[model samples]
Target: MLMVALCGAVAGFVLLGHSWLQLLIAGALGIIFTQFAFLAHEAAHRQIFAKGTTNDRYGRILGTAFVGISYSWWMNKHSRHHANPNRVGKDPDIEGEALAFYEEKAVPRTGLRAIIARKQGYLFFPMLILEGLNLHYASVKSLVTRSEKPTKGRFVEIGMLAGRFALYLGAVFWVLPVGMAFAFLGVQLAIFGLYMGASFAPNHKGMPIIPAEVKLDFFSRQVRTSRNIAGRFWPTVLMGGLNYQVEHHLFPSMARPHLARARLLVRQHCQDHDVPYTEVSLASSYGTVVSYLNRVGLAARDPFACPVASQLGRR
Candidate 1:
């Protein structure tokens, strides 16, 4: 993790020095950092090393320095997300102010709110970025106002988050020239924005947002709750193989590089077992999401209210 962070920093410094190289280096390093983010995620789930402690320790270090996130917070929150994905009232994954899934009770039905609700998907990208920051702020607030004693790991996570933020500030204000600093920040922001946008949209959106009343088996839930993108090599590399959303959700322990193979394996298993599986090409899947967003602004509605087996069906 230290080595990866150092390499990223050196690449970033080179990007700062050369104006023309900014975009190339930024894109490259952004991909590197994005991959590191996945590694941190894997570690948080104790999927990286044989020992849970080692996995957590590595996750914390890499998450703080390379990804600028706290692993402990991620683990706690993400566990909840996985446990209750798309459950409107229960899932923390619906932390974004712009809710994407509709619940019968929470439906908005008037004037501007109605308009926003109708076109909710279009605003999802910006909302996602805001929600990421919101999550950080909310976590810190929770930590400070807690009446009960915090755990040692929680304190360590908070401290690491603070340090990472400080380092980011220092890099922007003190380490580099104004222009260079802004460039670096811009690059980081681009990466952050892209990461959130690309990785999230396909997982649950455009799928049936079921009510808690719907009793789904484990395999059914896994298949229904996620979509798979048959992305080619370049896109897979750029997105850190997150395009294989269904496979990742099912086996979060597997490394990103192995997702495609896992997807194939899962597909064959599902076929043999007579289980339903959803797969769409990358372009079509992304297009479905965009079209949905264009139709629904920021309000919670079931994207898969009308399910189409293929992208053409959506059209």
Candidate 2:
């Protein structure tokens, strides 16, 4: 992780003197930031260390300083996700603030929001261009407003986030003209958001949304709600072990290297128990997510196509 961060920094520094072509470097750095975020995620899950404090120390540094994300905020949200993946009202990921992930959420929209809700599936990827900004905003918001009682961790993360932006933005402006620097940053943020969304969305966006009142055993809950992307080497490296999301959710602290073996074991166990397990190619997973979102969006459009309307008539 340290090596990757150092290499990214050196590469960015070397290319800063270039003209608008430096936007390429910005895009590459965005990828590097996503990679660092993956590592920070593992650290937050305790997959990198035995000691809790040790994991947090490295996670904070990697997430805040290198990736410019708030570790504490991510930890709080992600912990709930792991605990209750698709559970309604529990999983923060599905409580879409900008885009609706389920039918009921979409059905309540009005005006322009209603129009957007009806076509949200198609807009999802393009809208991800703003996700980088959204993530940064959410991180800062969580730290500043959500921290009911301020702690040392909050202060430390605030400082790290401030320092990260200062150094990163300072270097870009120092090397390029104002307009060029803004364009470079724009490219970087767009790529970062797109890549980050692509990798994480496939894990559970299309999976079953467990109603808040429903309950299931741990194994069933995790396996049923998670989708694994098919592949071993490249997928693991690309998604940072998130490709094996079933195993990761089942064994939150499992190291990235062991997810393959764990996947085999978990698959066999699920088969023996007659529990469903979903695994699909990366492209196919994206298709399913888009289709699922569009189907849910039906609730905001034609009543005949809306499942909620059907249910109401049945009642």
Candidate 3:
């Protein structure tokens, strides 16, 4: 069913050809594809399908088709994120940790590259471009450079990457006229950037950056380490169900369709258990993220300083 929806949407965009209307349609479908990717994420976690090989099979099929990312990569890294949350040096999800905390850092006696790295997260739209590049780079580097032998999962990823390249080439040469192809790619990239930025911005940015040394309890870790955003259906759908990030971090096995219910349950449990639960309207959450980014951008000459090192420097 998900595959059919993605195919129909991609085909619809292809058939429309290169008008402004075609671009609009392609953008809409791109958003739909992003939503499908989220569902694939749920499947990867065995939240959608029965928890077994069936879930793995379905997740790979649906996820790779909608997005170039592999289920293997997501499972390996994303699970680590949930396990460790925001443990500074330990979390794979922490993109250049030091760079993310520029606002609190002291003056740096360092290279010009360091300064740019600190403020890199706030360049906003461009970061999406960097993220796409980072995805490709990381995948390739992992494949070629990993010390361990390639597993079946890695082989599957190789196949998926090849398939993605073929489909992209086919779209360029055979599916549509050159102009229409360019337009399709442009709209798709724009939607991709928007999706990446919006989905991730609220996750951890302004939240207190924990040092590697801090030992936190489970509920305190979750409340302080994660954030939730409030958005209408459009943003939620566009973000592929990630708007309920707090629920996701807690119960990653729940399907996105069930996240709202899960959020209520988690809130109730927190109340009963006396856990410190954090809640913010979606608008305010996103606002907090933006404000943090702006402050980090305007403050330190180098925003990318390692939080631990910077804290020690302050002392």
Candidate 4:
């Protein structure tokens, strides 16, 4: 991990100064940044170390300094998402502050939002094009304006994030021609965004939503609400061990190396308890997500298609 980060930084510094290499470097840099992001994610979950603070150190350094995201902000938000996976009011993932991932979140929409809500399934992948920038913006905001009780390292994190971007922006603007710099920056951020979302959305996007009032046991809730991508090799490596979503949710701190084995045991446990275990190919999982979104989208305009409405009627 250190070696990868080092190589990325060294190569990025060298290439950023060369106008001719900016385009190629931008694409490679995006992948490198994403790899750091995956490692930072592991650190956030305490998977990289036995001690919590030690892991936080790794997370703060890797996520902020390298990925230009505030670790404290991410940790706080992600912790909530874990505690209440898809719980309607509690899970930030479906809160739809910017984009509506669920039916309830789409209500009260107007004009452009309403139009987009109707075609959200088609726009899901496209929207992820900006996720990288969105995450960075949110992370910085969380520190300056949004933190409840600011974590210990938040101020330092702010500095690191700002400094990281300063160097990145400075290099691109100073070293390359104006048009090429924009192209380089755009490509890097776009790939970073798409890679970030594509790798995680399939894990739980179309899974069962847990209503706010419903109570569930830990194991059952995690299994029922999460979907696992079934494969080895590329799936395991590409997803940064997150393709084992059920196991990761169940044991979020378990090392990435152990998730494959844990998945087998967790699957068997779910079977023993008759819990639903949804595992599908990566492509199929996306299909399920699109279908699910389209169903909810249609529900917005057609009462007959609203599953929630049908349930309310029975009551």
- The top-ranked prediction according to TM-score is 2
**Total residue pair clashes for candidate 4:** 0
RMSD of each: 5.9, 3.7, 5.3, 4.4
Every model's TM-score: 0.78, 0.93, 0.80, 0.91
Q: Candidate 3 has what TM-score? A: 0.80
TM-score of 2: 0.93
Task: Tell me the tens digit of each residue's lDDT in model 3 across 188-280.
Answer: 766765666567767776777667788887667876778766664765675667777778877777777788888888878878988766667
lDDT of 2 by residue, 69-137 (tens): 999889988999999999999999999678888888988877788778877889889999999999999
TM-score pick, better of 1 and 4: 4
- Model 3 stretches with alpha carbons more than 4 Å out: 1-4, 18-20, 97-122, 176-180, 231-236, 272-275, 297-299, 302-315
For residues 201-248, write the lDDT of model 4, one tens digit per residue: 997787888889999888777888899999987998888888999999
Top-lDDT candidate index? 2
Q: Least lDDT summed over 10 consecutive residues: which range in candidate 1?
A: 295-304
Once superposed on the true structure, which residue ranges of model 2 sit more than 4 Å away at CA? 1-9, 15-18, 149-152, 302-315
The 0-to-1 C-alpha lDDT of every candidate, in the order given, reads 0.65, 0.89, 0.67, 0.83
Better of 1 and 4 by lDDT: 4
Order candidates by TM-score, high to low.
Answer: 2, 4, 3, 1
For model 4, the run of ten residues with the poorest summed lDDT: 297-306
